[model samples]
Target: MTAPTARIAGEESARDQGLARGVGLWSFTFSILNGVVGAGIVALPASMAAAAGGYAPFAYLAVALVMAAVVVCFAEGGSRVPTSGGAYGTVEAAFGKGAGFLAGIYMWLASVLACGGIAAALCDALGALVPALAGVGPRLAILLLILGGISWINVRSAGLAAGVIAWGTVIKLVPLGLFVAVGGLALLVGHDPAPAAVAPQGGHFSEAMLLALFAFCGMETPLGASGEVADPTRTVPRATILAMLCVLVLYVAIQVVAQGLLGAALAGSAEPLADGMRQISPALGLVLLAGGILSRFVWIGSDVLGAPRVLFAFARDGMLPAWLGAAHPRFATPHIAIWVHSAIAFALAATGTFTRLAILSTLATAGLYFLACAAALVLRRRGVAILGTPLSFRILPLAAGMGMASMVVLVAIARIDEILAFVGLTFASLALYAVMRPRIARAA
Candidate 1:
């Protein structure tokens, strides 16, 4: 006999109540792009250059391909589940409550760390533009202000948040596109570095690939927003694929421009794209800097809006404190979860460095992705229909599984500290899960 149909709890339904489906194809595409690109593309070229020399662009393409493989796996999982917990929910079904609980905790921590990093980066960009606020107090204040503003907007309405994200994405892309065009022209004129500048040295592909992985880190945010979409199964997969494609194009284009202009020098510069533009035309430097700052707003907004919804999802499932599932009665958003996540993010921003936090976040998130891919394979093998529903893409589950496994290998070899931290955190979560299991089982 078929298993019982899964029902969303009263609280989960409350949080989702009156939440109009404002995200269509373009809005969904914009949200995904805004969520994925963030501030990474601005910094990634230099990071890749340090490792792969000129072949950095190829490294990005390779990373994108690997991520795409993972995305396909996610698409299948999402098509089946289409819930807010995203990887947490998917892994739970494939593995068990214990493993699923651990995955949820890691994903929550990753989102908190990542949101903090993004906010701090935005504050840094603002400080750069307005040097008078170089003092610690002013910068901290600015960070809080930005975070508070984003939280307020997100808490207001999902539709409003989508519009902000969609517009912010357009604003961010325009300057990057201009830089690529101008830089390409300069290279053709022999006014910039030769193609040899971007060519990889004898043995640095692995390092370059790791840096490229950073650029593709936030591609999963759209999945987190599935509940807010009109038809999640269709929109989620399309948004995931479309967003990945947009990011891949923007990243590869930026790398080509940066490398063609400054070559190895691009790797050394703190602001590689801006520096490349400066080489071509000083005026373009200002434009690129402005663009970076604008892009951070989109990142901050998307993170604040998306991350809390995941928390709410977990809470509704009794995996987290019940209070976290509280929604804004009128706004139809997870206001309590938003505030809780914001508090954690603010604390992390005040304390952690970007590099350190990013490493930790990437590891945790990658672990979840790895599990999600595995779940797809497991479910397909067991012939388990997700959400008591049929699924498309039978081969996707296996591809996602292999892709995730390969990423784990890469992370182990390249980011050993992150891997260790993730494992430690996971074990700690497992201990908590063991204690909570009896309670969760009783609730079920």
Candidate 2:
């Protein structure tokens, strides 16, 4: 048989032609950090404390423990396929082109809607940062610059974009890191009275865990750049695991510090992190204000690096127009795909219509994770490996099983509107798949 990594007889791998394979272990990890640790981190402690009490950190830890299993499936899929595909190449390997096509579009649609919502939020954030940008003309300019700039960078080079995400990660982390460090110090010196025992509340723990799930939601985002990652067979797995652990540690520490410093008041403060930092010193608190802005900014940048690759991946597989998968000769990047994705987001941001589709967010996340875990089980059982050789991970079966159960929990807790949104999107996507499958087979 031909080597597993080989493509179609005529079509070439993007990496073989112009797609730069330059993203390394740490940079991809940074991309993950930037993606997962968004603006929500700053505001999360207050709600978590209210719901889970001092056990707030434990609730987040509980979610992370479950996520560890889920990332294993992602790790295996990415290692086996090692391509720039949606979810992971293991999906198509398990389910074939038709189902794979559905999964691919499913994720791409979510990204498009998410990008629009994020873009609008970014504009509002920038407006808050610079009062001068509040006018329609100024806000429009901000949107253009933000979206256009990120697209230009990604189109130019995935490596360059990774570098930007690295700095963006640090820029946002400073305030959060400060909050943890200073707050911990405050406790040490008895600058604040000892925090009350925040024992876990069983009745509310489940609610808190589900809410905490969003903080861990972006693990799959950076994997979209499978085509550009260097040593992906090992790199993807390591980054996925490490980035998650780091976030879990960081989140738990921040929660502990906030709980110790703010105590009962933490459960009520709307701006817990910012307020906590302010208590240390006014200047530090002011810096935390910029934290939210920087966090969202980096998230949008990381999102640009991620979600477009599915578009490029589909086009490369002949499920979409080939032009989208074409790599830029000079930059070795998917410029066309990047531009097109950005355009959809820009339109959505400008019109403010992406909100209608926003309800799909939770359901879309559940579907994607379920598909990935299912793919992992199928691919492992089929003994499939598409990357010439697969890394040996002894925990595949156990991890995948647990991942599926975690997904079940996610779906079990989803609200009714989310279920409706999921059903609507599924029917619509399957109908489109039916119409397109025949043409693709005829072409083949």
Candidate 3:
């Protein structure tokens, strides 16, 4: 009996060592892209136009370059650790468990709030298409429906979630790609793209550039699933680079077309992409609306897949309930964590507005970025190595420095309320950690 029990325990341990590792290069790339390119991409041109006029495209370009440094830093740290929890795990490796818990909590809060906002946005987007859903009750119902469906898919299988996100990304890009192609061709044939390239102001450009950062928020998402990724050291970095390039191409093309077609009108329009597409053709406007719905789903799906993994990581570390660490025996997915995250997010969706949650999410994500960058510097200095050959780009220190500086700039630009919310969350995390320390020590 003892021998059989030992064998069973060994088998369970072996299964626990593997997090499915089903995520391939392409799927991983899509995950990063899905994280970075959310529904915000569609109307972002308008916001940029309002803020920077002719310099809006340049703002996008500059922000992308700055964000690249941050991504590189994350890539470096992820390669060294190549585990779940993303910034949380990396920071824990460098700083210690307490720091990791704090980082993980920030990320979890950010994703949960962002998920709520996405659901609310999804409801609004659907309402625009179907007037019947304009009422609060109907919208809330739809939000619940969306969350339920996504949670079901995620709890069933991580591979399925990856597949859905990848295919959803492809689908989401179609309308934007078409607009870019048509608009770019028009520009090539002696047509001026921007009819209103007004002089840009420094103040407006600064604000717009900061706003553009929102479009690139999800670059660290793929890292959250590192345990599930095959050859994470190589795959994570390569996927990060590829996803960035893809978004850069798409963003540049879309911005140019949107700027050219809408000109000054882009600044004030509610549906910027649809307005720009309408200028090309009325039919294209409808395409933009349809695409917006698809993009929202992709955004929510990305968050759903990411946040729960962080919770799973916390549980595995004994920061949360131990059951959350358990993957579904059949599906090998973190079913318990996913359901809990979905439930809380759904509650937020029902009660919260998008603007409030967006502000909080932005601040939380910026905080996470600061920690991730700082961890990169610390880990490299300490010279830690994982079991596998870690990826190295030789610019880790530089990348970390730049990434930290960029995050500081971001934090400075953030609103006062956001800063306050971040501080509050940090305190809350500390309190929770203090209470859980004894239990965690015993578990360890």
lDDT string for model 3 (1-444, tens) is 234323423433343384687899998897787677787777567667777887878887988877888888788878776776567778877777798798878778878987887787678767767889989889878977899999999988878997898788789878777878876676667554435445434356656666667667777665767878888779988898899888888887788787777766677655667767777678978898789788878878877887898888678867887888999988888989999999999988888766556656767777888899888777666665453666676887788788788877876776787777778889988898888898788876
Better of 2 and 3 by TM-score: 3
Instruction: Give the whole-model CA lDDT for all candidates, comma-separated.
Output: 0.73, 0.73, 0.76
TM-score of 3: 0.83
lDDT of 1 by residue, 183-224 (tens): 888888888462334434425677677667766876566666
Error of 1 at 388 (Å): 10
**Cα RMSD (angstroms) for every candidate in the order listed:** 4.3, 5.2, 5.8
Q: What tens-digit string does per-residue lDDT give for candidate 2 at 102-166?
A: 67776777667667766776676566557798788987898899899999989888899989877
Candidate ranking under TM-score, highest first, comes to: 3, 1, 2
Report, for all candidates in order, the number of backbone clashes: 2, 1, 1
The TM-score between candidate 2 and the true structure equals: 0.77
Best by lDDT: 3
The most accurate candidate by TM-score is: 3
lDDT of 3: 0.76
Mark the regions of model 2 whose C-alpha exceeds 4 Å error after superposition. 1-24, 50-53, 109-166, 191-204, 227-231, 264-270, 312-362, 442-444
